[model samples]
Target: MANPKELDPAESPQAFYGAELRRLRLAKGLSQEALGALVFCSGAYIGQMESATRQPQKDLSERLDVALGTDGHFTRLYPMVTRSRFADYFTAVRELQEMARTIYEYDPVLVPGLLQTAEYARAVFRAFDPLRLAVETDELVSMRMERAHILHSPTRPRYWVVLDEAVIRRVTGNARVMHGQLAHLAQLVRSNRIVLQVLPFSAGGHPLMQGSLTLMTFVDAPPVAYGEGPYRGQLIDDPAYVENCRWAYDLVRSAALSHEASLALIEAAAEDYASEQD
Candidate 1:
């Protein structure tokens, strides 16, 4: 087998955590598989953590600490490793989205962040936290815009999204903002950059009616499911749970309008917004 790559702890907090994990495992004379068994995770997952390709999760860190007899060392370091501009729970989702080979998303109330325009995102942020300062909102908008850059890349993930009709009807910033956002979606659809379907109100209740869901598949890693609500998000990597999420997404897709019809509806909504702006 090829020699394992050396980790540079200076690279980032995650890298540092990986390095520390490796050090403890080696000190205990344990192989990745051996350590993984102790922690109740797969050997490959341990390797991914050591390579800084996967962020360490809180519960896993606690388990690792107990398994390695680290006296809460890993648990204490978990927060630092995950700290980012994005919410703690969303940091991993953001990282995985960039590395995914295919992405399937379902949102009930708002446009998915990957497809949101600057104005639309800004308005949503402001509305969610009316007391937030302008500078804070600006910072968030910039980060979100930067995240969307992956969609423009040549190797961008195959993106498919199902949006509830409410997403299009609700005026987010203003009439003009809604018009621009819908127009942008139309352009993306027209350019074949993404596959989008609208889950109309007429479809009635669905499997994913409770909140938003994102399912991402990777070339080298296992698939993951992310579910988000107002302020909380959960990322699931367990094979069984991820499979269930995939099934739910498939159901949502089946209930949504066809691509052509969805585009027509989007265009009609854009026209309605345009008229309101006038």
Candidate 2:
């Protein structure tokens, strides 16, 4: 068997937690499998935690404390490791995005974060909280741009997105910003970086009209779904619920324009924005 990969404790809070967990487990003379058995999870899960590839949950941390006789070490460190630049509710979803092998998204009102240009992201953030300071807005934009880096990774997930017509029709920031944003989307589509479908206004009504949904599938774990609204988000891992989200996504896809048609529509929208800019 191959030796386990080495972890750098200095990488991040999660890495430190993972390294510490490994140290403690070894000190207790327990293999990952043995420790996982005691915690009621799979050895692969323990290995993932040790490698900082998986985020540790509160309940799992508590269980690790009990199994490793660490007296709440993991439980106490959990919050620090989970702290994120994203919203509290979105922390887990961000972590899962890094591990997903495929990602499917449906947006009804705006461009998805992963596909947003810096100016577009700033505009959205400013609109969401007009009272926010410029520095704070900059920080949020930086974090968002950092998240977009995953798409450029060699092992980036296969991304498929369905966008409602309003996403492109609604003017964000100004005509210039909208033109740039739409142009960026067109470039991405033309380069085959992502599969995009537009759900036109003529589609009438759809099952996912209420909110946005993201479904992610992993290589070694079960699929999960994320639903988001104005200021709230929920991460769902229950097989039944995830399956239902998948079904809704399929229905939405059926109601959306074909990839080629969608690209043409996006290009036309961009041209309209450009005309307005002139």
Q: Estimate, for each residue in 122-169, the C-alpha lDDT of model 2 and write its tens digit.
A: 999999999999999999999999998788889999999999999999
Q: What is the C-alpha lDDT of each candidate?
A: 0.87, 0.86
Displacement of residue 86 (Cα, Å) in model 2 is 12
Error of 1 at 28 (Å): 9.3
Q: CA RMSD for every model?
A: 5.7, 5.6
Per-residue alpha-carbon lDDT of model 1 for 232-272, expressed as tens digits? Answer: 88776767788999999999999999999999999999999
Off by over 4 Å in 2: 1-29, 33-44, 47-87
Give the poorly placed runs of model 1, Cα more than 4 Å off: 1-20, 24-47, 51-87
